[model samples]
Target chain A: MTKPADTGMTEASAPVILGQNSGPLSRAISRLRGHSFAVANLLMAPTMLWLLLFLALPLGVILVYSFGSRGTYGDVIYGFAFDNYLRAFSPIWLPVILRSFLFAGIATALTLAMGYPLAYFIAIYGGRRKSIYLILVMVPFWTSYLIRTYSWIVILRSQGVVNTILQWANIIDNPLDLLNTPFSVILGLTYGFLPFMTLPLYASLEKLDKSLIEAAWDLGASRIWALLTVTIPLSIPGIIAGTLLVFIPAVGDFVTPDLLGGPDTLMIGNVIQQQFLSARDWAYGSALSFSLMAILLIGIFLYVRKVGTENLA
Target chain B: MNDGTPSTIEQCEDCAIRLEGVTKRFGDFTAVEKMDLGIRRGEFFSLLGPSGCGKTTTLRMIAGFEEPSEGAILLDGVDVARLPPYRRNVNTVFQNYALFPHLNVEKNVAFGLKRKKLPKDEIATRVADALRMVELGDRATYKPDQLSGGMQQRVALARALVNLPSVLLLDEPLGALDLKLRRQMQLELKHIHKNVGITFIYVTHDQEEALTMSDRIAVMNMGTVEQVGSPEELYESPGSRFVASFIGTSNFIDGVVQWTATEGSIVLGDGERVIIELPEDGSRPVTVELSVRPEKIRLRESGEEVQPGQCMLRGTVRDVVYLGMTTQYSLHIPSLDRVFSVLEQNVEIASDQTLWVSGEEAILTWHPSHNRMLPSSGA
Candidate 1:
């Protein structure tokens, strides 16, 4: 141990090597250290630049625009204003936010209910055919998101195949209004994001040791009870991942509400779009976008804290 | 080892599990083929083999994880082939101790009892008993991840044993443990087997572990049972070269019969005549292998008198390895190319030189009965 006075003297003085305070050797060492730091910064430059340009800059822009004034021609004015933010707390936006949440929650629930068994089948029973089935799950996306969403329109419309079949079967006297409803919005969202939910769930379920289930069986758990007690609980992380993937996207989706949901089904994303495009109010739209971003960031922070960073990755 | 009590006799006499022609196939691949075994109640039987040798497959089939494609599995005389694993009367202690990560030690142990729908107090009592048996009663609230590997393994054992199943299937349960912990757990497992008196169907590739704990061992290879016998039977009198080499250590010498009759003898490839016993109606000029344990080979001086019924060979000591307890000497025998022999550390050789290689002639002999003759096809 060094004496306290020696420690103080050492702390006050510059670090020296070979008992030399400053010389060519120290300059060479400093150059080497500078070169290493430069190389490290160069290696990490692309990722840091990407975060700044694509993530941080856009988020800063949105925050700044949230507090700025809306010009007459839908352009942001560089002046302080809190009116748009105050309007966000009005009953109009509150109901819209609650409605969007309701739609996202239902879609998440349905997606989980439907995706779980499919994921379980692929993980446990598909065996050597797992990758093939995974490719099959992704095959729907090969055609285009818009076309897939339109295909739902073709099926769920009043005179579409589903309604025609139901009418011909005499299950209903008249064609059902399957489209232009909250039900249609939920159905479309779940259909579009089902694979996102199923894939993560499959990854978690596949990692489950079959012997653990066997051990449960050896412990004399019934088939249903084993699923409830062991299999489902062990798959909690996957379920959370799937729920987040579906719910986060569904809450902010404007296409599903535009195509499948009618006038009363306008969500917050549609409201933001209307504020900037039709209403020509950039300030309100930017504030609304920033609020959504803030809520999502808090949600993701809680999620990472609950699960782990590696699991989220 | 009998207790001389009628109750003990009755308990040991019962057959806890019996498999009849049980065969499991994963699509085109045959995992376990035509396995027939009867595990006695309260006996520790091990299915020992290399990987993909159907040992784990057999244990899984017995545990009802894999249904045999063509056979019957009887547990306590009840057919469990068509039954799912949950309905079976057996528990499995899996490799890596697949304890429920979400549940604490007590809850994991209590899981089985709750399924049986026993009263809450009875479940608690059995859980406590099992935890005490594994010497982990105080760690009731700890989750599996919170405990050390050995403690987690004990919790797995306790979880399985709490149900009091007729048989416990341990699928390489100690495979993941370190060497010292494995040895300690091996003794604990044996002691638990004695205390519980439940049939144990252990699966492992470690011959030393099988020899130490198993009452009987079924050695499997390529989805077939090579041999099933007690440790001493399998080690001492192996019926085939695979068993002889697999169980312990043996040096094989390829030989053919030059002259054979009631008093059997054969000339080795290098013109050394070794004495051997023949079957009741053995054939002539048969290609066979002569097996001798390293311990049976003896070293003697060149001019030593050759005793009756002893085979001797002249070989130069090429290298010696001092193995603390025993020194292994690699000898270059002209009759057999090269051979290795182990001698006890206490024994002193005739020569003092290391590499000048004096005393090139070493006489090796053993009883003719110890010289097993095996068919040369699988060589």
Candidate 2:
């Protein structure tokens, strides 16, 4: 074998400098300690640049546009005006905003109802196959969300697989009106966000000290009572996190409504899309978007104030 | 085979809980073999053993967490093998002190009482009383995370004790405390047991803790109980080698019986003999192992007179360990090829002229009654 590097080196043979304050090595150590602030700034530069370029610039443009007037040709005319915000708060948009909230709230409730038990099973009773079950939960995300929404269309259309099966079974004389309905939209939203709710619930339930449940049982609480008193209360953080994650996005979701909702089920997202793409009123669209953000922020603020932000995992 | 104790069924009449041939097995491995035990009313009983010795398993069976694979567990003279944990009148103080993090100290203590749907005033008064018992009366509003580990342990105790169950099972409740706190908690727990007058079944791996707190102890090994007795009885006469070595420092000498001499003296092989008093009709000519406690062996200086009824052996001192309370001497006897330990109290200074040092010949002497003989097989 070849001789290894530093074979001749020993601790005593290493160089030692006298007058520690004046040595280059001592200067280097002092500089390293004092340069930590500069190093932290450098480490954060990329993220700051990305946020400024993508998020801040777009939001600033929207804020500026919201104050301008809509031009004759549907282009944004640069002029100070409050007409767009005034129209945003008018009764014309009330139904759409309320509808969005209704759909989001129902979908969130449905997702939580279905997700908690599934997460509890995987975390508490899955045993050695926990990783495999978690992988199965995430497997549906590999497909594009658009393809998944389109697949629902294929399943729910009047002449699609579901109606065909029902007709074959003679369950009904005519196909049910399943497509382009608010029910279908809610179903789509629940399916899309189910994993988001389950993962956090699983994380919180998995880290729970199992002995608390045992102690509850030992304290004369039955199985159902123990679950309600100990397991559910301890998992409030996961419930809050999952609700925020599903509700915030489902409020602004346009795809599921665009494909699966009817005219009667128009949410604020569809209204904003119409303003931008069909009506070509960029200022009005920006105003609606800012209004939605403000409402969501206020709702989130009240929620966090009520539940306490420290509980968020 | 009778140790002069009453049968388990007869004992169960007045006992708080009794286990009759309880056996627990998990698939291919047995966690606890056939176990028969009874805990008397208002008694502090301890199941003492090392890890995986089935002490905790036996406690769990009594608490209704595990059902015995073979036999029944009786609580208050009624079989509770089919009862769920919630239906059983027992509470467990978990080793981790699993106090609810979300609930404040008062609410945690009131959990079981509230489940019983007691009146609101009754619940409040009981919760206050329980908190005061654990010396946590002022910290009622503090969450479990806000308190120290010792305080959390006290809260766990209060929560379990507030229900006033028929039996209280503590699974090494003080195993997580530091040395000083653990000692303090041991005394406090014993005091609480006396004040509550509840049957306490404690499980621990610390032999000293068991000795300090238990009124009766069952020493278990290899998923089976080796011996059961009071602390003094078990310490004075351990039934098996495992119990002797596990409970305290014991020196064992292996030899075959050569002959039975009159007046309860037995001659051993290689012309060695010991004066152990035995009954007149006792059997002989079988191999035997002798166990002696280190404190029982006296280190005699040169020219020390040997009294009658005292058996003596000469050995060379190999090493010395100076503990604070006592000094242990390791003596090597060349003829028997064994090292025997002798413990002496450190009341006298080591510089005294009578003290023996390493490599010095010393005579080890003890009374014949101090020698305990067990069969070689140890059953």
Candidate 3:
């Protein structure tokens, strides 16, 4: 008892080991301690620089081009005007823009319908094979996107696997017109984006406390009602994340439409692609791109307001 | 004929819940086996056991979360063996508090009532009353993640209690709280049980909690019921060595029984004789295992004159632990080849010393009535 106070006094008066605090390097270290976030800012410099170079600079160039007009020799005149914006909103391009949104929304809904049950099965009932099932969801990512989209063509073409099987089974008298349609485009888009929807859904659903479902059942809720009220509501964060990841990219997808869609199935992405590549009107393309960004921004804002971003990751 | 215990297979309509030969098995592992028990209406009954001892499994069967692999579970004389939990007239308070994270306190409490399609204003009033009962009336608009753990537990209780089910199954409800909060909630739960007058079947692994709150406790061990009695009855007259040791600390001494009709003497392993009272049943046996609680043994200075008819053993203090209200001494008995414990109440510590110091010689004595003869093995 008499020795404890002496030990405590020695510990309390311990010397600071700042490694000779008179040097310029020591002083620089001391100054850095006053602003702790400076270290974090230093660590973030590379990623910030990358974003500026790749994302911000390109978006800024498009913003500037949206104010320009096409010259007679297919060169940008660089004149300040809203002519391209006005053309982007005209009835001539309205149908394509609406079709883009409609296809993206349907593909997202289809992927969700397919992915939720698969995610639920893996999270709740996969048992010891859970990691293996999650890896299976990611196997398609190992192949090139063009190869996977081309594989869908073989399955959906008039004389491919599905049509041959149907003809042999007497399900159809002749080979059906199954390819180069809006249905084929939407199918390909849904197939490609399914993992984006499932992985986030799996993350949230797997982290859900299973006892909440039991509590609902104990409080007199049927299985269906419990799914609607408890399971689905608790997984809204994952739903919001997956919807944004799938829908935002699906709205701008050109590969699926270019390969599978008919002439009648022209979406906004095809129009934007034609303006830049074939029509040589980069100004109109830039305007249409900015307008699309504005539409998605307002749409996401309204969605977040309605659904509440408080639980979002 | 004299004891009020209903014989096995006897149906009692007064029992709020009864299990008859209920056995549950997962693959080859039997979780609960051939269990027959009855709980009275409005009684606070506890199933106390260690984790793998099947207390939670029994609660789940009662809550209709799991159907027993065999036999019947009768609630209010109706066998609900095959019904789902949603169709049963019971609710469970889970250990993790299982509150809906997305719903506020009021909406959570109103969930079951709304399922019944009650009027909106009626649900509002009942929800308010339930929240007030748990003392979370002002937190009605707060989501579960915002509330503290104890507050979330109260909301779960309210969510279950607002339904007013005939039976409330609590699966280790206070297992997550700190000690002081658990004690406070234990008392609050007792009062709530009294006011609500609903039969509560609580499951816990804490022995003292069961003794404090339960009217009757069914002590489970390894998927079987070891003993079932009132807490006092269980502590005073445990029927088996498992119950005597599991419910609290007990010192066991085994010896050949030498007895007359009224009293008996045990010639211990080393031929040291000790006196004991015969059980009132008076069925004399050849050998016996006797359990004596720590507090039942009184520690005194060496060479003190122990009263006649009291069992005494000479020992030396090996270890001492000073709890606030009591001091526990580990007494090493030489002739018995064992270490015995004696818990002495410290009402007043003598000025010269604090209870018994280590390495001190002492004699442990207790009345013969304190010697509890365990039933013969395999009986």
**Interface Cα RMSD per model, in Å?**
7.9, 7.2, 4.7
Instruction: Give lDDT tens digits, candidate 2, residues B1-379.
Output: 2343334445445888888888899998898988888889999999999999999999988888888899888899899987889999999999999998888899889999999999999999999999999999999999899998899999999999999999999999999887667877988999999999999999999999999999999898878887888999889988778888899889887665555465445443332346666644566635567789999988886467778677777789999987657788999976577899999887776565445689998878888788877645623
Q: How many backbone clashes does candidate 1 have?
A: 0
Pairs clashing within candidate 1: none
Q: lDDT per residue, candidate 1, A227-260, as tens digits?
A: 9888988898898889999989889889889888
Model 1, residue B311: distance off in Å is 4.2
Interface RMSD of 3: 4.7
Clashing pairs in 3: none
TM-score for each of the candidates: 0.83, 0.90, 0.91
Task: Order the candidates by lDDT, highest first.
Answer: 3, 2, 1
Off by over 4 Å in 2: A1-45, A71-75, A309-313, B1-10, B261-272, B279-281, B302-308, B348-354
User: For candidate 2, lDDT tens digit of each residue in A88-171?
Assistant: 999988988999999999999999999999999999999999999999999889999999999999999999999999999999
What Cα-based lDDT does every candidate model obtain? 0.81, 0.86, 0.88
**Among all candidates shown, the one with the greatest lDDT:** 3
Give chain B TM-scores in order: 0.88, 0.93, 0.95
What is the C-alpha lDDT profile of model 3 across A1-313, one tens digit per residue? 0122345455445544344457787778778886667888889999999999999999999888889988787788887899999998999988888888999999999999999999999999999999999999999999999999998889998889999999999999898876789898899889999999999999999999999998888888999999999999898888888888899998988989988888978888888889888988999999999998899999998987778755421
Q: What DockQ does each candidate score versus the true complex, computed on alpha carbons?
A: 0.39, 0.39, 0.45
DockQ of 1: 0.39
